[model samples]
Target chain A: MRKEDMVKLISAEGFEFVIDKDAAMVSQTINNMLTSPGSFAETQHGEVTFPEISTTILEKICKYFYWHLQFASGKETEFPIEPELTLELMMAANYLHT
Target chain B: MMGGICSRKREQLVIENGGCRGVSERFCKIASSKWLGNSFSRPIVDCQPGRGKCPSLMDLCIYKIREDIDKYSSFSILPRDISQQIFNELIHSRCLTDVSLKAFRDCALQDVFLGEYPGVKDSWMDFISSQGSSLLSVDISSSDVTDSGLALLKDCPNLQTFAFNYTDQLSEHGLKHISGLSNLTSLSFKKCDAITAEGMRAFSNLINLEKLDLERCSGIHGGFFHLKGLLKLKSLNIRCCKCVTDLDLKAISGITSLKELQAFSSNITDVGVSYLKGLHNLTMLNLEGCNITNACLESISALVALAVLNLNRCRLNDDGWEKFSGNKNLKVLSLGFSDITDACLVHLKDLTNLESLNLDSCGIGDEGLANLTGLTLLKTLELSDTEVASNGLRHLSGLTNLENLNLSFTLVNDSSLKKLSGLTSLKSLNLDARQITDAGLAALTSLTGLTHLDLFGARISDSGTKCLQYFKNLQSLEICGGGLTDAGVKNIKDLASLTLLNLSQNCNLTDKTLELASGLTALVSLNVSNSCITREGLQYLKPLKNLRSLSLESCKVTASDIKNLQSDALPNLISFRPE
Candidate 1:
């Protein structure tokens, strides 16, 4: 729909990854921040700032979110990760709970 | 114009009533309209309807908002926060299955009850391990969960209640997995036959265990000795464990915190039951089929808090029956198949709070029923196979709430049916009387709410069977005898809700009975054994494909006839007995 309906996720290097609210909600942490019980800063502004997450790891997290959404809908495909990005990707996966 | 007028009056009511009920309907109208326009930040205000005198407009707005919210929640792609709320609703509605559990896979679930769910054993532990300490209570009773699956729950230190009844592969060793959960309070191993007395060593660390059920566990004989240190144990059930004797009760008799004990069909006798001498807090005790006699009742009567006492199949004669009259708190007393008689009825007159009394097959007769007249609160009186005829039923007229009365195998006939006409709330009547004829069945048409009617040996002619069609609520009809003919079954096939129909031993019934029974699409159980129907009659039952159990025993139908029948005929049949 509209760009305002989407949520903006800002990484450590000020790299903003804006996506549809439905796709971004595949990450449970982002979904909780945007739909917490009361009006917290992220829920009010529709934007979350992850200072600990780097630009590369946050971009991978956003891609993994879309992949999870497709996987949940019965789509079976390889979600390939490079050997060098494996350990860091796993760390970010634990943080985002993708 | 109506919307404007409704909004204007709603604004006035909102300003008057303020916070609780009338919390501004204008906000809901704006929020609902925006929710329809792709905005998901709709304020969800939870409210209990009919709590206050809110105006109809506000209630209507809440109803419409809830309807829209329900539509939004049913979608598969809901946000995590909103899905958790919807998950709570699904749990309350008892709709959580393996398929639905995937929707909230990321959220930490509080209670998971996968009892008897297929293929839930292997991956269930893997899923709970992901929960990471939010799991509190789980009941995987009668499922495929084994000891290894239960061992995975060791990480859940806060887990309180775990029930693994009928988990076939789980042994006493599997119980060792749950030893370290210090918060574990209740454990049920009902018919989980792998648990022995040695397996109980796993539960020695559970200091908070309050209730333990070991019904039908054959391996548990001297397990009571292992539970001596559990001071908080209040309820224990070891029903149908034949080896448990009075000596086992003597080992745990010092645990005065015991409130409920069920050892039905165990080898415990008067000496075993006497060990429960001064357990004042004991509320429910079931010693049905135990060898306890007259002397055991002397000590049992002292437990004043005893509310439910089931001595079914026990030898509770007249001498032991005298000790029960003083225990006024008894609400349910089952002395079924015991040697109690009319002399025993005089002692039960003072039991004013008795709600359910089962004296099935004690030969209470008319005189015994007279003594039970003062129990006005009696709701269920089961006197099946007793000598209490029509004359005794007049004493039951005062029990207005009497709902279930089983008078099977008595002198009840046409006159006896007239006696039951006053008890309007009777829902189930099992009159397996040989003397009841077509004339007596006419009196039964007045009991319109009857759901179960069993006349096992009664002779009801085809015309008399026509009178049964008036009971449209009848779900089960059993008239297994030699009297019912093809025409009698044909007249009663119009009962669209009939699920179970038994016409066994009706020798005069022919292939015409099959033709009429085929139209009964709702019939699940159909028994036409000992009839004159041959292989030709098997073709007529093609329409009864929904039958679950079909018995053609002693009929003229051959094994070759069953082989030749169409493959799709009676496809849902699970039980088939043919001759």
Candidate 2:
């Protein structure tokens, strides 16, 4: 998937994914949610919107989710951020229940 | 020749498009080379014989751009520096096999294989060899590489961590080879039967060696006698080394920094442990299967900071453990397979910070377990294989923060579990191999955060499934050896977080039960083995993306079901067992 297209799609979900895809995919729950269309339905119609998720948090979560998916799929990417940054992402994941 | 190079270059340009282009370009380049001058004027088939109509320019451009941005920038095709960095990253990952391992080994062993490839550029070899000095750890476990491989590694001066499994392959000569790498701080040699006292002494040259293991080295007679050179040694494991006696332990007592020690199945007696009185920094000690008496624990009492101590299968009766209670800082104590009785409970009251206490098969009754309530910080308490009754569980109500409580093979029943409503933090409660009915399981609704609740070998029927629907956080539900059938199994689909659900030994369950669980995509560990599940049931798990560990032990699964699992099919699967 193209990076800009992914950013635009996930921006509608309300998370900011800053880091590369490696760190984001550690939570298997988020990866599966990203792949399937109905996994993250915002409303009753299942239009796939992250209305509850803020854009900043959506961007970070999307970037982290992509990094993790890339890392888990065995595609080459940058190393994970420091352990402290990982804890921050974990907190974000915990807040979103992802 | 010049005309052939340009066409080959154009073919190379196309070859870089994708895997398909590479094969065609190689064939076309070979065909154009042999038919030198006649190819330019010949039919289009001469230049591109098997080529389908050339793809449109736009399609070629799309493929080229996709290849350049995604496939082209792959580490294997990138510049030497970035590819070398990727190679370093692969090695740093600590575990690899097959193709990834071959790539890493090829990149690092460039210097070793350079003699065969004389025409290879010097810059690539230099870039690879420069990393030789930066490696800090080496694992030569279970490999056929011998002393020659060790000799090649003598240049790694900064190497600090090393592990070797099946070290019987190394002789005294091979052990001496590592003495040159003086920066070694940790080393392990598993199954190294050929090592002698002289071989161990050669490692004394490593002044920086702080941790060492010589497990299963039967020939280590008087191997640990020389300890003056090992003044910095802190952690040691000499399990299964029978030759070690009081003399070796006395020598180790002088190393003040030694904190963690394992002497399982050794000849060390009370006299040997008496030397440990001077080592005050000791925090963890395991003396399982040792020939020690009550006097041995007097030395262990001096280790005030001791947090974990294991004395399983030791000669410790009530008296020996009484002397051990003098150590106030103990938090985790294991006395499995010991002669502990009611009298042992009196000494356990002082351990206030105790988090985990294992007294499995200790012949303790209700009165003995009642003394354990004084330990308020306890989280995990194992009383399996004991003769305790329902009254024993009543005393456990005081441990409100307890998360894991195992009561397998006890006399507890439906009335006894009512006492457990107080343990609101309980996440895992095991009642396996008990006579408890659904009435007892119904009492567990208070534990709302339960993730793993095992009721295998119980009398839970379909009605028990109704109470279980409330546990949304349940990840592993083991109802094996129960009366659950296809109808009972359908209730589990509501558990959205279910990763591991074991319904083995349910003879009544059929293919439909497995089909219901197949929709649970979050499942990673599933065991429906030994049931009436046939090939049709096995098909349900084939598309499960996250299924990692699957156990089909004693089931009717066939080899064809195994063939369906592709090598890299379920990318996340770590273990798959089918029978």
Candidate 1 ranges with C-alpha deviation above 4 Å: A1-98, B1-128, B137-151, B165-174, B191-198, B225-234, B254-257, B534-546, B556-571
- Tens-digit lDDT track of model 1 for B1-579: 001111122332332222123212211211111111122122222333332322121222223323333222232333433344445555444455565555455456666666555566756676665554777777878778777888888778888888888867887778888889878889888887777888988877888999988877887778778888888999998877887888889888888898899887799999998888867888889887788787888888888999988887888788866777779899988887888899988999999998889887786899889999999888778887689888887888777777677776777668757767777776767776788888888887778887767776788777788888777877677776578888898777888777777787888999999888878887766777788989889988888765655677788987557655535576555445652
lDDT of 2 by residue, B1-579 (tens): 111111223443233221122213111212122222232222222211113332221222222232233222222333333334334333333222233333433233221212112222323323333337665666555555566556666666777877765654577777787887788898888668657888887687888989988876777767776555777888888877788888888877778788788887788898988988888888888777789866787788888878888776678778856676777788788776678787887788888888888776687888888898889998877776678788888789999878777776778888889999889998877786558888988988888888877776678888788888878898778776558888888788779888767776777788888778877888766766667777666767666776755666556676546546534355555445552
DockQ of each: 0.02, 0.03
For model 1, which pairs clash?
none
Model 1 lDDT per residue over A33-92, tens place: 888899799998889999878898788778766765665666745454444444355445
- Once model 1 is optimally superposed onto the true structure by TM-score, how far is the C-alpha of residue A9 displaced, in angstroms? 24
TM-score on alpha carbons, each prediction? 0.66, 0.69
Q: Residue B100 lDDT in model 1?
A: 52
lDDT per prediction? 0.71, 0.63
